[model samples]
Target: MLPTFAADDYIELAADLPATLQAAIERDLGIDPAQYLANAEAARAASDVATALRAQGVDILGTSIDGQDVTYNVADEADAALAEAAGAEVTVGPIELLDSGREVQPAQDHKGGYGYAYQVAEADETGSFPLSRCSVGFSGFDADGNDRYLTAGHCGVDEETGEQFTYPVHHIELSEPIWATEDWANEFPGPELGEFVPGSMHFGEQHDGGLVDITNPDWTGVPQVAGWAGGSGAPDENSVTIRGPIDAVTGAQACKSGATSGWTCGEILVPAQSTPVGAQDVTGFIFNACLLGGDSGGSVVVGNYALGVNSGSTHDGRTECDSWVPATGPDDTTGDFSIGYSLSTGEYNALTLLGSEWELSVAINTPQVTSPEDGGQTGPTPTFTGTVEAARSTHRVEVTVDGEQSYEGTIADDGTFSVAATEALAPGEHTYEVVATYGNHSRSEVASGTFTSTEVQAEALTVESPTNGQTTDNPRPSFTGTGQPGATVTLAVGDEVLGEATVAEDGTWTIAPSADLPVGERFDATVTQAFEGDSQVVTVSDLGITAAPVTITAPEDGSTVAGDVVFSGTAFAGATIGLAIEGVVTESSERVQTAADEWEGELVVGEDGSWTFTPAEELRDGEYTLTATATLDGGDPELTSSEASVSFTVGAEGDDDGGELPDTGSSNVWMIVVGVGLLVAGGVAIAIRARRGGSTA
Candidate 1:
């Protein structure tokens, strides 16, 4: 709960504290001890009249106390005695006196007035009429949404025209009486009479109070030449007074009010008094602000809040006064300028009774944390913050994070509170709950929100196969590697999920289906790996499979071959195999399987030597035997037979028929001889023809 001002502290102590400290307290707690004391004192002084007027209804004009109105004078011995008797140092002023007509203009005689100074408007344009000096003032709103200026009851006439109102005089350098003529006065100092605003219905003509609505709808212009020029000094709480049980009696410790000169503090001068209503005695308090003519309708407040309006003052024990002259005459001005009357609680009750009033009440929805998604790899943290307003004092709040209670707090006297979560949350869906607390009266509805913590990591899973574009039935096939683990791994293309695998505990993981892997179709897989508070992610690739298991064939080994020597083999579709002579491949001896399990191609071999055929689809002639391979489904490979070699012999030039052909390790020597004889015969024929031609030439 907010702390209230003490009943005794004063302005001296409040001003003594460091400005920074005082400002900090005011910012945080909204009150100062000394300021509260001053307000209480002011209220005590005002209450003397308040109590009496609340009981009765009019101001007793003849009862003057120290130059203040007798019905509501703070310095009056009777009022002070009554206060002390009632167990308070001062009386709280119920300063809500509605003025009949009066605008809050600039103070006129600051030196001679009480809290402020003001000038009263005269009726005649000749400037020969009597004008009262004003001091007290108050601020309020009128029916037309205009600022209503208030002041003393005796400031002027037009009780028939409307409330005794005044106008805002901004400038302080010009003439004495501003807006003297009716035409000029009608522009500002005048107001509509039919509304009868600023007049308390129940306290008509009781407290000698009056009110006037500032005519301009928008009055942002600077003050007139005769106005107070915006006086300094905000209200000081330490100057007020307190009396009565504030909650029970409709009487608070202190009320606040403002005037043409500045803001001021006062107390209810009386509890209950019998005073005059238009020459008839009614009851009310007399505040101690030492006011004059213009202060008529100035506002009175308590604890930084508005309370009442300033009204009439009386001739009392003040200096320089001979007799009790009428308040309008100059003789009464010399006595004292520090007294005024205000409406009593009864008057305000009667006016406000059964009327539609707007109370201060508002509520804001609880905030929700935004960010990290549950089980997500990348996002923000879980958190939320904001405020709510409750009109009553019994409100409390409950806060939860991730579906768990995190904090609980109570609303202060001003109806404000806050809550925070306890610990950092993980990535994933989280829900918060805020429930209002109360007793039998009924609790407020609960509000909730959902949010996520940081996001999780994403890892990709991939697999590579042997053949580029082939499928086979090979078992125990070889694979290149596995993809990153913890990622959702599927072996398929598009929307299809072929074979699936979760990344193993280690970085590498493999998925081998129990059944034969699908042939022809493509597969893709994905996985999520949470890390770094689930904030980082990575994706890898999965390659399509190539199949294997090929068959290859070649000539005998350790023999030379020439011409276009053809080699054939069966390999997985899109599989390539090489044919080599001896340990080196023949020039252009590469062959590829155009279709599944079928391959054939020709390679030129030369001289008597071994031609090895190796499994290579595209390569230069080299010294390697031909071997075959096939790719099965899911792109795995199976090896075929070892390299097979081919050999062939070429006869030497001019060799006889009996001379053995260059041995290519032939099993039959005679067969080689025959082959050599045929080659020699062909050479001899060509030579013979050439010799005959030369002889003929």
Candidate 2:
């Protein structure tokens, strides 16, 4: 979702958050920070339209926010047209003040949008102290360089006992093993991370916050925040670097990671000074996200900057964050909002409350170039890759080639970036430099490198695989060799084109002939790989392929015939033919049937490459299968074909014409037998006709 062209949130969002943080934002919220803000803006505009129409007494059914489209559902198309004309897409929806939003009816779980909400708060501040817990927000340095963390001030106060209650801040390595389960805060008491500052807390009508003085030696002065997305894996929850306070913007996305609810993100419905029912006239802003009872004191952030501390939520009855869901947008009037105490301008600004001399941490490191060595040769459009400070949010990278053409890309969460030139650089010695911009608009030192561009100067093609004189059994053999990537490689035999392949990214090429080459025949082929035009060709000579598989060519498989039962096929000259028979049976009597036992033998192939063989005995009038396998006289395993088989029946499908009859020489015998059978059939027919009193015409 894109914000309105006039909205400043988009520009502010792009500038406020670093690329790594932006990536994390999208990962946790399931909404681009810009889109989340845009949705809010769009929803706000739509709400105004709805209110105006309602004032005119227009009946609005409901409202929805999808991307930048804010719709108002009307009872009829007449209202739709009117709403559309008023600048909001017609379906219907709203915002305003709250009377104890925390005590309002539970928020509708099935709200509009699919944005993710992190349920990361730990103990419910509403829960009785000693048994309840609150979440830590951000870390900072005190006037004496002492490490300090901040949370909601009301979280440390025990309203029940009113003794200024302080609870142990258990320290656990933020990971799935220790922090994934909801009850792990109580189950795994790793260690004491820090201590709540004595008398350094406040919960007034204008502000609410507290500071936790860091006692752990290793964690002092660290500028990191706990980032979780309500999952069983991924320490993504431990990410997010807080670079001090930044004023919050209405309609922008805000997130908080807590032990009670992992990580929930939503849009700010109001920037500040909103009246709500709970804690009458509480000093806070309203944001639409899933904040449970224990979320109080959890850090609320907009981009990479610290915004506020979670105070409480309207949906305090919810137990768990079911999944990442979208915000209801800023127009939501249904008391489904959470409160956060301002850290930038409120009376409880962390800086003033902690120590006037306290300063937030900011880190920036120079990026390192790891590709296109100091003075190496590379293709014109070489890809540049490098690394930046791993934990830093290096968002943008720029690479200039020869101080001319430049390429840019977003840095990844892992603090690495890659940019490939869109066009070829001028051929010759060129100096390239890379620069990265990360957190708090910190720029990395220009990482420079020197390289010579080959332009289109491709290396001559080489046919190394054939190796001058090579032979194989592959009828269509493939050729392999190295060449410059991005070049087209061609394989040809004389003027006849075989096939072509492009040189792969690994500087290699492979091609094979489209059709099988003649067996036992040797020839030379030319291969050329180049850009723009053909380059010098490398010839692969004395390359040959082996013979074709033996093929059966007699009696056409599946044909029925009564004859001498001969099998014929073609094979390599001087090869031996191993013949095997199956499914053949002969019946000596009608009462008994006998199955033919294994019938197999070997035959010598003739010099002409064609062979014919006849079984020593006649086959019965039944189906049979004959298999002929050819074995090379002394050929290599890579130079021979597989066996061939055919099936035929010794009956009506064929006669002596296709196969010779065992003892009979001509068709005269068959004619005589037919003439005798016909005479006997006529006499029997006349006798039957006389008995039935019918004519025998």
Q: Write the per-residue lDDT of candidate 2 for residues 1-697, one digit (tens) a residue.
A: 1235333547664444434345545765576656654554454444444556777666665444444455555777777677666665554332243343235221211000011122123447775223445666665556665666667766555544434545555554444312224454454445566666778666655556677666766554445555442322333543556533555445556776554555667766655554442443446667776676656677676545667777767654666655424346454445467778777533435555654634555444466877778799877777788787632232678898878888888776467877877776667899988887543234557888898888566766777686776887777888889887778888888788889998888888888889876565567888876563335678888777777677888868888765565667887765555555544233223322222222221233578567765444465554566666666645544555468878887765422222211221222111101011011211110000000111111
Model 1 per-residue lDDT tens digits across residues 22-85: 4433532245646554544344344344444434433322222221212232445565566445
Q: So what's the TM-score on candidate 1?
A: 0.31
lDDT of residue 509 for candidate 2 = 84
**Model 2, C-alpha of 101: deviation from truth (Å):** 5.2
Per-model TM-score versus the true fold: 0.31, 0.38
Clashes of each: 210, 42
In model 1, the runs with Cα more than 4 Å from the true position are: 1-138, 142-217, 220-267, 272-274, 277-283, 315-344, 348-697
- Location of the lowest summed lDDT over 10 successive residues in candidate 2: 682-691
